[model samples]
Target: MCETNHNHNIKLDKNGNCNTDEHKTWNRRSFLQALGLVGGGSMMLANTPLSVSRPSPLSIALSQSTNENILVLVRLQGGNDGFNTIIPVYDYDVYANARPLIRIPPSEFINLSDDYAMPKPMNKLESVWGEGQMKVVHGVGYENSSLSHFKGSDIYANTNLQEDDRTGFMGRYFGEIYPDYFFNPPPSPPSLQIGSIGNLIFKGPESDYSFAVSDPRRLLQIIENETFYNLDGVDENCTYGEKLRFLREATNTTFDYAEVISAAYERSPEYTDSSYQDDSLGRQFRIISRLIRGGLGTKVYLVTLGGFDTHNNQIQRHQQLLTSFSEAVSTFYKDLAADQSEDWAGRVLTMTMSEFGRRFRENGSLGTDHGTAAPTMFFGPALNGSGFVGEHPDLNNLTRGGNVTNTVDFRQVYATVMKDWLCVDEGLVGRSLLDTDGGPFESLDLGFNCSGTTSNIPSDGESLSHIPTYSDSQTFINIVTPQTTHIDVSLYNIVGQKVATLANEMLMEGVNMVINVKDSANTRLSTGPYVYQIKTNNGDYSKSIIIS
Candidate 1:
């Protein structure tokens, strides 16, 4: 098991310095940075280049069914301090008592409701709220939330509490919708991910669905130059050489979308919104607005704003982060509203998500520690009205560790958005979220519905279940099939080189088939981690397995 350290649980002295031995551990960001993946341009996952001549049936169907509504997921990279962001004016005494130094004065905050107010740094949202373009879902989080940044992020992205689960909910949805995604990707990039390096949000079973760039500047360079790596000289004879060649080819194919992105950017009007600061978050929103206005057709876009882990000197740091977020978001809508022909502002929905919230009580430092539950803010005219969705977590009822119990499950929020905003089918949304374990999660009404238009994608209703297990000597794959289906199974190395074809035959109905890797491969396999992909008429599923 990986070592877990809670940032808020660290012992600090009166000087606001750690007094205990800090466990120097690797989080997802640092690990990706060490691998030279973070801030090193775009990440190319295992996806085939989209064919220009012929669009797939699934692609055409998605194009026709989708009403051009887009979802922008803004990630507050570190855990945001919910108490500070959404001040509980009704319980101001308890809130002030917890953080007297960092608490926002009543005069400094703008009142949103009789009970709740927002800090002055986020004053820009006040106008948005008055226009009925904003809504707050109070105390949104899961039970037993992981306070560790890496794990918490994974839980949010994958919607799975299991530590070993790697696939994300969006990835699973894309996998189901485009079962033949490896051979035929959609016309445009399915999603565009900017920043938030090493996040699994768009990770499908066999590949990642997003065209992920390190930053807005790198994306602009790709758009301007139509850049791609040349794979002419790569030797493909040896195993390592073959993997390198494959990766390079994949990287080049990823740049294929650059042409469309560039075309869209070139056709769109320049951002003249002076309210948008020339900061990281502002730049991201600016680019996203251009793509949407220019008809890129991408459905989802994820952008990041870091430095939310306000462990010390909370007042100034939190203020700056929230200020950037508020200004960029507010200005983005105005930029979209400028395009009166499209009503682009109504078609776009922006939502904020952080891994978790800060503790109810303040630590020795002027900041709060990692806690549970925070207010999730939804912005855009599509919401129809501005209001709170759920009750705020009670300050009097805190966990033994000084964390508030989440009043609303974050998955419920995801399910609702997927069903309503994106027009995804309710059943498919449940499956995509892996909500089968506890039965389907109930959706919350956030003032909008799908308008009777649903996705054309078909759901794989318990047709197959692919499970992989390992013994001391060999690996075994247990597959359950409800009906006879042609199944193809293959294994690939970590770098995405095809290692072996395990099976290429039909699976009988109502039969539990367990295939031994050693016998199926008919060769000695390397003793390390490998991914096994199961392809069937139902869908494609993949999981990581260790060979001994």
Candidate 2:
């Protein structure tokens, strides 16, 4: 008999084993809701709304900028059993003894080298490896890893091992590149997130940098329909009717980026190749491929594949998941390669990440529990060659908790990718990764090296800073200039109309200027949301404020 435990959100049998078959019956809406995609941000895309942070004029300007390389983050939602995924050919005896029931037959796995092999279910990756487009980083994790899935995922995304930090490494990088993010967002999304709804990887200090959607079908509908929100049916007789109309109109105008997204989708050729699977992950990759081919200049994308939490029926369940993942990734690369003119395959990199690895030994239930460290896989022609980067953890040596000790710090891989593949400056990379105090982590040699790349970040002595503060029923724009330069500060409404000129004069060097918005406007202001923009010779910055 099977019993549901609402507290733990799982189903268990009389023997206390997890009901693995339940995963097979999950519908799209239930799966997405489980992933926490129900709320926050704006509602734009179809029934399943797309979460989006309102972009500023500066954001619009930055979106027009372009970068050569792109990154695709494949989030393996649950903890993957690494020992099963990457068989230890060198230590086969020890591995077999550890998981005798779940041990893969020697002949069943595809051999990569004398030291390691991949399960047969992932045979599709053999071609990717043979083409010199795939590489694996062994035992990639942080020290003192958290076994809890929620905490582990947060630690990996934020790159902070000590405590729960809301900001992510990518978010920090985006924040640094676009300091005035709250005021001026980029033209296109800085990143596009397709699953992993609640993941903090793209969360900036004040707002999330990515435009997120729960599923590809809704995103497709958005592109096809080319409409954000309909305000026609709103009843004027309803309570707060004027406010309701104003809110809807404001929301409709804010989603103008939907038109931009639709234009890009329309420009790309229709995806007619049926070789790609018609399942969840495959459909996601198909949409991503279209966006990339259609000239959507988003730099980073994150897609997810769950069901890695195989605590029961390990053999059948794991095989199915791996098979799907391998096939989807294989077809995604082929789809990109179809565009011969752009060399899209050579410019894009795909990386896989999980919260953690599973226990080194299989449990009585025939599955492994949450443990530590796993292999991180990278795929793309840009990798230049195929091979393993770190020494595999010794099977005989285990921690007190029976988990594999990490041989490579995951942050090292992130630092290397940010510095080399993304062409970010070494100094900014250190700051973004929060390793500035201890100095930047050592970057690994992952085949390619950045050359002739110059950073656009301004020096500390040349940068300007602004802070908006509310005190005693008055609004203040506190400006700290690095050196005296002409400054112009203005306020605008939700509809992009200038409402007040807060400041339009020159300030002295090393001076701190604070302007009172209410006194400076020279008119009575209503209570609502407003954007205050500061224009200086150094650069432009803006942020939103709520007047209540």
Candidate 3:
């Protein structure tokens, strides 16, 4: 017979095996009280059944309606040789010469229209890229970097030069941006990281905001502990009375919240099928997509696809590696696109980065070794087109022996996303996020030069009549700065089609200079992503923003 325990929250007949509680004891009062409260590894109170259909207090407090804003970071484990991944097909002669046997024939690539394209396996991305929703940042890395896989990944993950603290740069961003969310569980699910194991990026002081969930179906098994909650034997050892009470309260509090999260996930759709690798990492991404689709309230999700440590048989292995990596990512993006969740299209941003790129030349063993400077790809929603951000160094001009000299630092990318993409303020983000051979990079300027000085300088009084503003329901984007007197701002669609003319005239050197835009009427344009470019008479500035 199945044993039942009421107050203890645990049940065992005689053999001392755990019996499922089904969260019967998770109560409403305890559940609501724990809502919106940050989490910690401490004892909690006994639980009672919560209101079935009511939203958790935490979810209500966040008021975070589905904005569709999601960040998915896919790590291509093992060293992905950049040279072959995005081979210079136009310059195939040089590439073929470098990679004699391994070079993928030009015909094999998914021809990305203008002479460049991803490998055949990455054809999935080619479709998205052609659609203008995916972006590829080429030749991104650091200078004088350690080639060790662990050290390199540390650099990518932490974005710190010395790699001292080991906290994820994203973790710090999440911690600072939503301290309460990081400290407390979101009303739906874990905020920062959702996987079988929590990453360093999700770790915070007193922060149990991360949950290492392997199976959403199994989460309830951990949440409802029948033996611990029952009033009868909770004090079986009968130690300190005060300690026992503290433990009970803490346990109850945590389990009550956990129960709510488990219930939400239980209703989420499962995406994985036999075609997926059936690996732990594969399963994790599938779950992540489900949670995101289910509106789990996760902001940044991280999952690593390992086995990139290609030392031997690097040819066959690396080929398969890239194939699997691209396939998984391509499918993931498609899944997000198919998701009917309100936030899926507008808010979700999926990106990938490695510790560093592989060496420029193949090693003696026909395999490329650890090197620096690789490309990072940002896929999904408002992300702009594909192109190399930093210049790829000449093959002959190596950094040390033959390492590709890094033109753009990795942290610059992080800072750009943090400051511009995510609206995080680097100045107040605390501590230098990336270690420069010099110091922290200038706050990640998204290449949008808004300096206060420019030549055609419109005086303060000049009515920049074209300046856009939210006069009514129309969305107007105005470019103003302290550096330039006049700047040009234009809107472009994914097809490289210039949609609306937001600003093509002069502007003053002050704040709130609104520019009236033509063709910006809500009805004229369909809901989707658009790129905004600002070309100052002095320099060029561009940023991508989504219009709801």
Candidate 4:
């Protein structure tokens, strides 16, 4: 709704000529018409294809099918600090020395194992991590990663390291499925962007395959009731007339899209997922979840959590962003579970993507500068690869470029998703990602790793498999689960003073959890008489562990 600048003192006639009394001023409509004819934008959608009335726009899944692979792509807008996000347990000293100003203190680190630990703020993902539902792919980047957010994001989205292609990986996928999307859009909306459509990540060869609206309810109101008023008659034979016709026709198609989106929104369930973080990200995911729960048949969804460009005062801001993201994502999965959707856990996959990562060393401004490789995380019920995927880049030995060298090619990830999750042809996936040579890029193993079980075991059947062995370095707890839920355990001195919080996490069912315990450093526990307790969602259980 940008207004065109015009000279205010001039009086003009209806024909856009200078006059004396009445001024027929130019406005948005005429400006749009001018653009329509001048740029010939109307030619883009000249022929309305017959399939506009198709069941859904670019429909890929059957409404009654429960096995469709659903992908929830999360864009981390700013460069994320991979070192801080996934603390390096092996190179703690080097990492701390590099970013002393913004490092997470050793004492406060949450122990995942002797090899790795996450920031305490990441505790929301503890349950997911424990169940092997999360995968941390480290050192994800392309060669010569761009430092500029705009350029880096484009590279990531376009998957064109050469910066030569205009089509994104997803865009190409959509284009392959719906060759003439401009003329005959899917019966239902193909892809949905929760908030602003930040980029053309979903742009096809000739047109964009997705649509975005700020609010569903408001969109419904606008499409169903709002009216557009065009100006009165002018010359029908003039250049302006033809341009006006194009603009009006384009306007009509836009209205049609609005109506389709509103109908899909109405089809979504009335109840919103309540576990969200009550922020923009949360609100957006809520919309996504309801659409899935209500069976909208949308194949792709784009969710964003921006403000990652932490060039200054990053400690608090980064933590807040991670917290919001963690809570919303963790809860979104749970919300799907609460709905008791049969295939949600197995069908829906959520992955995080970023433009790039910050430098290893802290800058003078108390924030790390933009740099290269970072970790990408994935969570879902059908995830086979959990924990760390690639070896963490050596902090002591950085590349000559002063960045963590990529351990996993970003295209490998794209190829994996295309083939494993979205079921694209392997040959198409390989070319879509790595370009001309290969038929299928190496697919990362993201299959469901844990065993499925019925959650009907009796309360008395659950217990610690054995007394956990403890030392100053660590402790091991073998907790057998009857069902999947929350579990917390702690150690106490002889006098009942709590010594260490060993495990406060969610555990999946039907697995023996060899839980590890450690303080800040990867050291064993002290020798002494200690008592341990285990708490489950069902009830509390306790045992003794004599480290001596």
Q: What TM-score would every model get versus the actual structure? A: 0.71, 0.77, 0.63, 0.65
lDDT string, candidate 2, 1-548, tens digits: 23423332233356766443333322322332345432344333222223443345554443222347888889998898888888888999999999999999987989998888999999999999999999999999988999998999888898887767898898887766664444333446657766445458877675565443445555456556666665665543322232344544533433456666656656777544478777778777877787788887777788888899988889999999899899989999998898776888888999999999999999999888998999999999988999999889978889998998999998899998887888776766777777844767787878876776534444334567778798876778788887889999888764566888999889777799988888898876555556777777876666666544
Model 3 CA deviation exceeding 4 Å by range: 1-68, 113-115, 177-186, 189-196, 205-219, 222-242, 269-281, 341-343, 429-548
Per-prediction CA RMSD (Å): 13.1, 12.5, 17.5, 26.4
lDDT of residue 260 for candidate 1: 66
Which residues of candidate 1, in runs, are more than 4 Å off? 1-64, 210-252, 271-274, 459-548
> Which prediction has the highest TM-score against the true structure?
2
State candidate 2's TM-score: 0.77
What's the lDDT for residue 485 in model 1?
Answer: 93
Report the C-alpha lDDT of model 1 over 331-427, residue by residue, as the tens digit.
9999999887788999899999999999988889888889989999999999999988998999999899999999999999999998888988777
Candidate 3, residue 4: CA error in Å? 24
Model 4: per-residue Cα lDDT over 29-82, one tens digit each: 235434532111111111110111112221222111133667888988888888
Best by lDDT: 1
Q: lDDT score of model 4?
A: 0.64
Give the residue spans of candidate 4 off by over 4 A: 1-67, 212-219, 222-260, 263-272, 437-439, 448-548
Superior candidate under TM-score, 3 versus 4: 4
Worst 10 residues of 1 by lDDT: 45-54
lDDT of 3 by residue, 268-350 (tens): 66544334555554565566666566665655666676666665567778767776676666666666666564546556677
How would the candidate models be sorted by lDDT, starting from the highest?
A: 1, 2, 4, 3
